[model samples]
Target: MQWAYLLGLVAAATAGHVSIPFSRQDYSASAALVKRQASKDITLEALNNLTGGGYYSEFSIGTPPQKVSFLLDTGSSDTWVNSVDADICNNQQLQATLGTCLTTFNQSNSSTYQLVSSDGFDIKYLDNTEISGDYFNDTVHLGSVSIKNQQLGLALQSVRPTGIMGLGLSANVATREKYKTIVDNLVDQGFIDRAAFSLYLNDLESDSGTVLFGAIDQKKFIGNLSVLPLRPRQLATRSHHSMSGYWALTC
Candidate 1:
């Protein structure tokens, strides 16, 4: 389910104005709080000409961690990869065009794979293509942080083998058993302080961007940081009660 809330930051202001550099904001903190503060910067590979036309990030799954490229998206919440058993995933042309089709998840190779449910996993994309499979809990590593028992879907039926890494809020997370998304685990495990991240698209032609977790890079922005609230999305008189996902700002 997707829910929209104003994306506002509560930071201490000096001289009745929020500080620029973002990191320069002065706020009283406990000694223990200062000790537990941590952050991570994840470099996203720009995929301008890819089928998705966005960014991709590397993620390792399982105990030894099998490396895979995930489509970085904020619109969905289910972090899923293609399984070897997918029926419609054997398109040779798609494999050549999109490198993702050649990749497949081998559960037998993973020692940390824990089956959550054999049923109740399904996802429908914007193209009206659906992928369904079993849900599993395994260890996932994003940068240096090792998240144990992270819930992810293993697609058994998919048109394309490309996997997506959803960076949306918990309200939009897709899972029947109710598990924590990667961002939630990051904050829960103290890898990041806040639930906010910044994505900077450096080159439009390259379709490249940089994603910073927990903190924003001051060098990315040219001027002052204009923080805007995330207003609730209301299309027509009736709100989309079931349409819960995506970072949509009311224009």
Candidate 2:
């Protein structure tokens, strides 16, 4: 079953979890401790945009790692980042007032970035946001856990300014062919055990929340984690692509 807590942080799923400490002080790693004694746990920060916009994560990409912040999207299937050539990121006057396109990926700067397809990546969101760009694989670091050679999209042209890290299913991807989602790669790469994640937004007043990938923290909720079956898309026809990797209706 899909839960609301799925949007926080992409945490580790293992017997011994790595806890990456984050805070509102300066969005720095104040403490990063891996607890082998704990059953399963990780503490990565997901800062809320104070205006009640949503949560975003501070992560790094590239060989040496370039810092970037991404909007944590739960419904989006294709994970993508803003390219240095993107209109919003390049022409700062467009949305200059908002300053949303601040972070971008310069493929040439990353020694590990490998271009897979020049024009194979394309995705559209329910909000009418469209992003089209080249597909590439690079090293992405979430706190201390590094996902090497992870496939992601580099948006050359984007309707949205900020990049997004999609946690949706592989079948929901808009690529030429279905590819493994980030969660899937985590398990295959021996970082996590399962392709499951849970979100825990501490409270409305809190500065940040947590997202646990692969393992569920039983202490957050009441009795048990409800297993909600994926209901077939009823809001639109089978031709609709926006409904992919999402629950038809909330339980």
Candidate 3:
């Protein structure tokens, strides 16, 4: 059976020769998938994760590029980071690596950082963990390209410290209006011709994978990719509307 390739990205400027790295370490299905359709370019990049089958990508936030690691989750739509002043990143949370929110985003040093909102940013996980923080707009560097005034959550209180780089569709974004998700901003800023991407994961031994944005890596996969329409009706019915945040398709 043929599988559909997953899509997501970090917004930036320019188009050709754009690529980034995704880092993580876990044992899961590790295979590459490429997409081509209606004449649009597909970009590719690597991901990184330490354990528990999670994947992360590298992006430079703020003016001088304070490099940060974020879990590339297409299932959700709000991208957030833990602030250094947050009390949630305690010693106990640091010890337990599983579901532990690591890394504190220092917003003060960012020359381009701007506070957009002071309230109503919250997210609750299945395990009863949650986070609440203010919203801010800043520059995000994807490889050498730069995307200006992108919205991101600056967490002040969170059950976990690890931040999330949400790639969900803009229509389904959980945050307030006047801003765009990572994928949406990419299309609006001309970083990619279309708002689509592909995800690839390596085997347990290799612990490596790639996520393509506006261009695909032909060397990663063989055979033509079959495009699957997003089946919201079927998926919503199956999920009972609870898990409808993802780009669900009835393939």
Q: What would the per-residue lDDT of candidate 2 be over residues 1-251, giving only the tens digit for each residue? A: 22354432233335623333222222211122112312133223211211114567778889889887677776667788888888778775655432456688888899999998898888865433467989999998875688888889989887556677787777777865778877777778877676667666566566576766667666565654445556565456555535645534555
Better of 1 and 3 by lDDT: 3
TM-score of 2: 0.75
Better candidate number, 1 or 2, judged by TM-score? 2
lDDT of 1 by residue, 91-193 (tens): 6654444344646677778999999988667877543446788899899877666778888888887655467787776667656556788777776777776
Task: List RMSD in Å for every model shown.
Answer: 14.3, 11.1, 10.0
| Global fold similarity of model 3 (TM-score) | 0.76
What ranges in model 1 sit over 4 Å off? 1-50, 88-100, 232-244
Question: Per-prediction TM-score, please?
Answer: 0.72, 0.75, 0.76
lDDT of 3 at 82: 82
lDDT of model 3 at residue 144?
Answer: 64
**On a 0 to 100 scale, what is the lDDT of residue 246 in model 1?**
52
Model 1 TM-score relative to the real fold? 0.72
Descending-lDDT candidate ranking:
2, 3, 1
